[model samples]
Target: MRRGGDWKRGTVERPVGAPVFDPTDERGEETERATSASPRLSSTLLQRGKSDAADAEAICEAASRPKLRKNFVPIKSPEQQGAQMLARVRNQFIGRRTQLANSIRGYAAEFSFTAPRGLSRLQQLLIDIRDDTTVPNLAKELVEALAIELARVHDQIAKLDKKLMQLHRSNEMSRRLAAIPGVGPIGATLLSIKVVDARGFKSARNFAAWLGLTPKNHSTAGKNRLGVITRAGDGMLRTVLVAGATAVIADMRRRGSRPWSWLKDMIARKPPKLVAIALANKLARIAWKLMVSGERYRPASAVPMPTPT
Candidate 1:
């Protein structure tokens, strides 16, 4: 069937035991929209025509080709769906909160009341503005309202954090995944829920490529060329992984933590943001290995302390 509004509703109402196939076009864009049903089928057949009936016929014709059915997207369980929803909601609130904070900062700048960086500093600035006699009453009231909204978003995010933490504790796989240096409760839980079976990927590199962490290859003849990441898969997952990598790099730089000597040298030579992307690619490979092998990470010993001269 052509997967659309009414069709989607009907597909969701199908018997739980029945087999359902979701077909993606050549671009592979509709994969995630099929959270309930699967295995996914890829075919150029669906692109034959834009009409609903033509699309339905194309799906039927595509189903007949055994070669086209080789690639299938795995079906996600209800639990995983719940976790994805929670993550999406939390992400939405984070964006809104940032917008409100920026608005507060922008408006205050017009009055030459520049606040220090960071959320705490912004909140404090709002309080000071509220009490200052020189500030206009209308401006004070507007800024106060923004502060209240920002506080509300903060409270909601905290509630989601508690929920994610509970899920992280309950799931053995997520807890095991949290053993990785940069991975926290949110990243662990998201990975567990998003990737049902890392073993399905043929190799660690394939898994990293699937996450779009690997560089794009454009090779012809004997010469080979590479470009930036494809940015083609699970954008939210990729974003969080990069964010975790950033945090790890920042902490290591500040504390001079004893990471591998090669990594230290790379950090010194490369731009920090580029290093973070590279680290995130390595982290993806490590997570794939751990997931496939069913082993928790074991940290290497810290660099040997120097002996007294």
Candidate 2:
């Protein structure tokens, strides 16, 4: 078995007593796993060799390995898939809205009008485009059409956001994870639905590494070296977590929240972006603990501190 784009739709039930192994194809670990499972060398391991038959043989061989069964990708429930689809659609609309906004701004700038930075200002830009007799009517009509589309997209996004909030409120795990700083409805629900079993990870560090928040190791001959994040799994999850961390950092900077002392100290030593990644990594761990222990997050201080609600 392989976890590709179609696996969610095309996957069939595993036969009785048949082993399953989902090749993490995007990570290029498919052939490696095959090699570990069988005596026959994978086509990927051979120089100047490739064929569909060879690939099938490799998969057949790998399926016989007793250790391969644990690597199967978790089957997501319809609700989980729905939530993920909602988030994805919301993200798509957000990106489209941004593109439309920038297009409007760029058009306005050409006419010596500089719109203020904010989505709320797009309406004013539309007004300016329509009323500015100095501007051509054709350009005005096109900009108006784009503005209409943007408004519709915004409305759709708002509806999806409400749905996501509903999900966050309804799911106990999502609520518990949401109690952690830098873990909001989006982040919490994403993890709650996407991660089938948090205990499958041996430790918090493993969870963070799976999320690709930890630094990459490149040590040799007793010389230790580390690099940027490996970015191994679920790029969208990592992105949202980092975004939540960024919001937390901004709030800490504005309100001087004491609960974020660790973030502040890290900022003093490292760059703000680096601090955000570090905070996201820690948030991943906290989320894992909440999932495994089935406990709500308890803030360290009595003071009312501001974070994602």
Candidate 3:
């Protein structure tokens, strides 16, 4: 309920001689020899409170439950943490790059020197502004400064992308995930970085749900009502999956290639955005199975994909 164990990430070590089932941390660990851990929820129905003492009491009660192991936060190695850090920084740079590009475009539009969309077009727009004599030199100077910053951000992103590519090449799981139809290098690398242990997920659907690819349930009176995707889990990972799915659909349409029957049917009935989300969900499930079972991907989806392990 507290939205994953992100609040407790980093610097916590699985002590050299600690039990795998019982991990010790600075604050607490659920072991007979030390303090028991209770992953705090957004709100404990058993006891709603606003003070530290009340929170501790609630945590103690929650830890008394019989099945608390599933809620334990997965500990990360230094390498895994570094990988996540790299991916996050790259993602941030990408966002900043887009923002800077848009700002430059908006400012350049004032001078009636608008360029087409796409990052490549941004550089050309800057060139046009540099050459245009009618545009005020002052405005040009400001835009030029933005362009410089944008270039710096772009260089940083490219460097990080190269590092991720190298990691993907060396990581077997990432390579296997990239084999999935809708998952490219970036999406595959994200899955590998985020999913430390595939076995921890009971099934493919659970993995998909964890990635926030599944629909939300709003059922009542024994009537099943499904809403839009919950959009939980890692926002960046989900976004990459959906973007990759959208690209896959576009390629399929442009080349007039045969898509999986279900995908084709969905495309026919659903709006393009909805179809992309569905395809992304399928990709997430497929990725989960590959990670768990170490199976090769089958492009032909007519043969059903493996159920989540």
Highest TM-score: give the candidate number.
3
Q: How much lDDT does each candidate structure score?
A: 0.75, 0.74, 0.78
Between candidates 1 and 3, the one scoring higher on TM-score is 3
The sequence of per-residue lDDT tens digits that candidate 3 reaches over residues 39-156 is 3431353455477576656555555554554454565656887898898889889999999999999999888989887998888899999999999899999999999999999998
lDDT of 2 by residue, 1-309 (tens): 344422332323343333434434565443323222222323333344567665656555455554543344554445665777787777888899899889888988898877788998777777777878999888888888888888888898889889888888999999888887778878998888778778878899988998999989999999999999999888888999999999988997799665465665678899888988998998898888889989878876312344655
TM-score of 3: 0.82
Each prediction's TM-score against the native? Answer: 0.78, 0.77, 0.82
Q: Which residue pairs in candidate 2 have backbone atoms (N, alpha carbon, C) closer than 3 angstroms, thus clashing?
A: none
Candidate 1 ranges beyond 4 A from true positions: 1-48, 56-72, 301-309
The window of 10 residues in a row where model 1 has the poorest summed lDDT is 5-14
Winner by lDDT between candidate 3 and candidate 1: 3
Give the per-residue lDDT of model 1 (tens digit) for 1-309.
Answer: 344432332222124455434445566555434423222342356565467576556555555565543234465556666777898898999999999999999998888778877888996778778878989999989998998899999999999999989989999989988988788778898898788678778888888788888888899898899888888667888898899999988898799776556567778898887888888887888888888988877765312223333
